[model samples]
Target chain A: MFQDFKSDPFMFCIVIGVILFVIAQSLFFLIRAVKRAKALGISNEKIKNTISSSAVFSIAPAISIAVTVLVLSVALGYVLPWIRLSVIGAISYEVPAAENAIEAAGLSSGIGADITDPKIFTAVAWVMSLGCILPLILIPLILKKIQKKVTGAVNKNAKWADIMAAAAFIGLICAFLGRGIAGTGELATNDAGEKINVTIGDGAGILSLAAIVSSILFMLALTLLNKKLQWKWLEAFSMPVAMILSMAVVVLISHFAPGLAAIEWRY
Target chain B: MMKKNRSYIDSVHFYGRIWCLLALCVMLLVPTLMSLHLKAWPDLGIVGKAFAATAVLFYPTAVVEVIAYAPLLGAGGTYLSFLTGNIVNLKLPCALNAMENVKVKANSEEGEVISTISIAASAIVTTLIIAVFVLIFAFNPKFTALMQSDTLAPAFKQVTYSIFGAIAATYFVKHWKLAIFPLAMVSLLLVFFGSIPIGILIFVGVIISLLGAQAMYKLKWV
Candidate 1:
């Protein structure tokens, strides 16, 4: 008993194109590192530097691109105002009669035409701004901490904290997948084509199914790709493709479900 | 050694000649289709105004990077700005690589290696701070959702997963470094010149980028 959100196809394609370009470019840097390594005579010390540099260099651009695009979109919305229409206008005929009647009555204001309230925009903007910026700053700090712990100044056994953190991340990922799936299930119809009702009760099964499928696919692809191909291109395309496809599916389901973002707007 | 660098120039020429036309075509078609289907086409005046507005907002960092922080002098700051700009909104690779080589002078008796690491770390920190500022105050998912509709969400999702792809691709390719300047320029052109047809501009830019790159290579710029 669930309905899925409809995903926007146009966005999916746009994201795909972006992903391709980023990956393609990153691969270029990797190639450069290799050539540079070769040029330097590929000694043990040089090779190590080359490897680390390549890895770190790639990380910089990928992170930069992602964060930039996300933040820019939000910022532009703020600095520049935009209008979004929610309710569709109703159809009408007898325009001449209506115009004449309205003229006689001197009542010409159109009903049901409402500009979005400034308050809601301000509130949403505030929340969005916070969401975009906070994590960007914090994530790197957290990553640095993790790196420090993993490669300790003093060598020690792997800490329980790291293990717990990994587990938590996995759990969060599962939950996200489950939510997507559960939301999608609500949009599904029965044999009679009646819309299924989604509530807390039926959310578990769909979520579990989606999570299991996603995990299995992720693991299988990782293993297979690692076995067969060099790491760079595989890393560049495979994981992102999976993430985008799943996200697109979930979003599409939501879009088609009229009840999903069914927030009532008052102007 | 010089010959090897020169070969890079030739490769850019070869690649750029073919790809520029394709990019140009795509650039032309995609935006036009988007406008028609979405009924959201902006007239020339509107587009120009919007473009100008965006440029103004970016000008501060641009000026700092391009002028105050000259590539040869204020390399670190310039690079930091370039990286921050990429992470914030636009993906122009303008002076990022050149900034990477900025020398970090440690007051202490630290060696060259230590100094280099310090510089890199400082750059990273600066980049993060810029990104945080952008994200915390400038980002707007709601409007993005409006402009992109629901599709933007999945693209984001794709991006999350694609990190691994970036990592992997960066790890394995040979001579990947040569690709950076061209890639960065292409990304810049695509993001800014939205009016240009992607296929055609790509075709032209790729050609131009390659040719330009080859010329640089021949001149031993690499």
Candidate 2:
């Protein structure tokens, strides 16, 4: 019954319907943006570069997300995880949300238990859906107001406006950089949701640090080569290209040397 | 002369509102319709408890994310990204890369158009990739195990590092003066506080950077 309920055709139909709607939304915006770009006299080259680069960059990240789909599918089935991950659900939230929903409802002995009962399944789905529903509702409600405040306040000084913009991006990047440098940071949960010590300068920490540095170096090399060799195409796609190469390095290190994103030494 | 149509920004809002609202309904309908089809109604009491558990942690970050990302994403990009998810890891970076490619500044007309275009392109590719994964998993369970294996999980796990490292290379150098203070402070704080949510740290980092920028502006160093 658990397997039958999970693989139900009705669920697949619903997920497909949601996916189609999302794709339609994307297309709606894509076409409008392209038309507007041309209308604004943006060159075809620029538009093409944006699309090609974005699409290419998306592949690695998309696959990473697909992996989350596989993980979540085990418990929730393919369709629920599919809809969740593809539309508004993220790894940091979805796993815990699903687990909590199950435990809270007293539906299973432990999480990842085959949820045979439809009531339990529905309850889990409801929590995951409703919990992350804020952004979807808030954006439409308040985004324009937020934009108006920024525009009215900051745009008066164009230099300041650019500074604020760069500052925002910098802040975001720095937080992620700190985390990358920190790895899972002292502690993280295992599959059983048990807290465990995560050693830095070794284990997961070393790998994360290594990946970041290697990726930055790759980007630097790509940027230099693009400038020196005048590889115009590489200029646009350097980041994604560099990221793919870095992921390869990770696979290689894990496969061969094991751990360490860079060379290590003992004094 | 062709009559200038509704300003692109205005029209974007007009359409963005409609589409986002439609998406909200569709998103809500996922659980709503599923239960109806199965004829299985969950206990409302159990549902409330489950919702509260995740909501308490996620809601604050949701507010931070919408505020943090909306400015950078522009109007159309905001609507599309909120629906499509993975904004930080994929869409935002894609948009930034696109604008960087064309030498456009955020908060400009070119930036708005570029962000929307790249985010849209990214959203399509991501959805298509996930759909393909679903297809493969449905047909072949064995292959899914290989994908979920320990050997390759490192590469997937390290994705965030690689992406941010690549991005940091661009911005850290470009905005060194404005970035240094926040980067140093946040990295230092994170080393000590390890459990601090990245979302909250991002909000704090933004505040620090803004303050740093303000000081630089006052001194005319920027």
Candidate 3:
């Protein structure tokens, strides 16, 4: 009765409807925010700058996210991944969640697995949707309380408030940076089934580290150019430009200099 | 201006809640309808096990994120960002850039408005891009092949690192004093202990950085 459900038109229609709903939500907020910005006396130029730069900044990351959708679609079908990635699903979280769901269901866990079985597919959808549901639930319940306390604390000491914000951002950066660095080491299995790693710096870890360094360099160079050339407009595009260029460079290096690329471990 | 701002925020909360609740219902129905149509309800036990595996880790992280990101995102921005997703990677960065460009601080009303504008723009653009790609490329073998091509794999893999690295560099350089201790401590942990979950590391870094900054402030170093 449920055969051909994976690529069914009904499934695609549901996914498309969800996507459109999200788009409408985005537009609602966008129109409201723009009006508020105007009421707040922000210049049209500044508002335009914010919108254009943000739209520019989002392109590379959105493309990367699309790539994720494409990869997941191969296994889960286009409808589910498209809906998942467009909504609360992230690349890092969705892949693992799907694999775990498949494993828990005693199904083969990988892209090549036959996931067309309706029961198996239903289980996956349920698991994936339920897994990330907490944030949606929590945000509505506690966000206002949290914001009130945070705003009160910050308002008490404006100077330290800036420091607090800066520190939080720094902490986030350090976490990502630390992870990138840690990924560079080599791992080996021991007799006790424990994995040991040597810091050889020739894997995805090192490649990621290199990408970070190259992107930073590109940003610094852009900063210098902006200063010397008085090209203020470049400031908005600097981060995205640096990101795209750095990724392009790494891709070229990986293709031409295989040794420089992160080694893919095969079991 | 203050009264106007407060009322606007209140209205945002009112509308935001309704929109999010509706979105949540739509999300739930995706699976519910599929099950009804296919007549294949999943094993509840299996679903529970899978949910536990992911939720145990993610639930706490989600709580932490709302706390960590609310100030930066403000009222309207926070509601929209949480609903639209991609907070750290896309929304936060867009808001940061907008605030920086507009010369507004997050604590100020101006900052809140600018953040909302930027995040809303980002959400719109991201959704449109995804929609276009899904419609245009989902059925095309050539597009799928190109996306999965060996030559482009490294670029895709490094995209997150490059994006975050550039952002980190910009902010770290600006607040080097506040950044040093946390960066050093986190780097040490990574070096010695392999990899720590970002969720935990963020709190560790925040606490250390806050303490360090406070100490420096008391010492009149800034």
Candidate 4:
């Protein structure tokens, strides 16, 4: 029963249904927003550019998300991960939540660890779903109020508002950068309770750090090229292109310098 | 005319609420239907333990995210983004870039619409891409191997680093005054704490940046 449930056609259909619903919701909003843009006197050309650029910008991240789905599917099965990553599930949140649920159920946690028990599977599913439900619930209940306060504060002073917005974005970006850099040399414990040294100077950590730096450099290069070559079109798709190129760099570096890709210090 | 524009936003909230409520019901149904079909329910005890484990960490961050992201995303974009997820990685960046490209202030009506449109586009594309990828590689062993391969693992692991680095370099160069203090503070906190959740750091960053901006304004530093 457990094995039958893992790759069940019905389960896949349900996941597909959820994805379709999201797509429908997206289309509904897209059409309405485009109409609003038109009513507000935004030109057809600008609107079209926004749509095309956003779609282009999304491809790299979307593929990355697909990688997450593939990662989570090994443990939770394809349907659940597909459903989760598609709707409101961050890879950061899903994996840890799934592991916590598995451990709580008195099961060894990892991919392919006999998670086919119906109760175990159900527990993992519920935990993953319920854990992330707060955002969905809270946003609907309080978003208007939140927006009103935020807009009100910003409206009080135009210059200050501009500064605030820029600051908030900077803060968010800085936090992510800090976290990424900090993780470069952190110690990670595996399921066997062995400590592994993850160093950025000459291991997978280094490759990860190099990807970050390379992406930044790539963006700079794109900026220079856009200026030097007089090609304004490159500006719209530069970030995504840079990101994909950086990932490709990781692949290349790992192939040529395998020792720097990953080195486990078993202790 | 102002009244008409206001009504448009109002109607968006009205419709957004309905859609969000419906999405919630649909999301909840997944677990319910699964349990019924499998004829297996999670033990309440284990469910409680699991929920506590995750909620203790995530709930506060969820609250912070709503507050931090609402102003940037606006109402319509916020609704769709929070519902569809991937706000920080995919949707937020897409919306920001679109708004920047179109030269609209995020506080204005035009900004709101542009944000909504861009987020909607991004959500659609991401959904389509995921659907296509899943269809192609869902059960394929070779594809799975490629995904889990050591050579590719570093690339996948560093995706967030690459993305954030590019974003930071762009924004920091553009807004160095606002960028300097928060970047320093957050980096320090990360060094000290080892692993702070992005939500908490964002909240802290907002407060610090606000203070920093206010100080610079008072000092006539622009």
Can you list the residue pairs that collide in candidate 3? A203-A262
> Of 1 and 3, which scores higher on TM-score?
3
Which candidate number would show the highest DockQ if scored against the true structure? 2
List, for all models, the DockQ compared with the true complex.
0.04, 0.67, 0.62, 0.63
Better of 1 and 2 by lDDT: 2
Instruction: Name the best candidate (by lDDT).
Output: 2
Residue-level error in angstroms, candidate 2, position A38: 0.4
Residue-level lDDT tens digits of model 4 in B1-222: 754666777878888888888888888888888888889998989988988999998888888888888889989999899888888988987888788778898888899999999999999999889878776676576886787677876677677667777776677778887778877886677666754556666677778877887888888786
**Per-prediction fnat:** 0.03, 0.77, 0.73, 0.73
Q: Indicate the TM-score of model 2.
A: 0.93
Quote fnat for model 4: 0.73
Q: Can you tell me which runs of candidate 3 are displaced by over 4 Å?
A: A1-4, A110-112, A184-204, A263-267, B1-6
- Clash totals, every prediction: 78, 1, 1, 0
- For model 4, residues A130-243, the per-residue Cα lDDT tens digits are 998887788778988887777787779888888778777777777676666653343455767554654533222566567878988998888789889987677777777788
Please list the residue runs of candidate 1 whose C-alpha ends up more than 4 Å from where it truly belongs after superposition. Answer: A1-7, A42-48, A51-267, B1-33, B36-39, B56-222
The digit string of per-residue lDDT tens for model 2 on A14-129 reads 98898899889989889988998998899999899999999999999999998888767667778888899989988778887998788887744434556778898889888888
Model 4 residue A71 lDDT?
66
Error of 3 at A190 (Å): 16
DockQ of 1: 0.04
- Candidate 2 runs further than 4 Å off: A1-3, A107-110, A183-194, A198-204, A259-267, B1-5
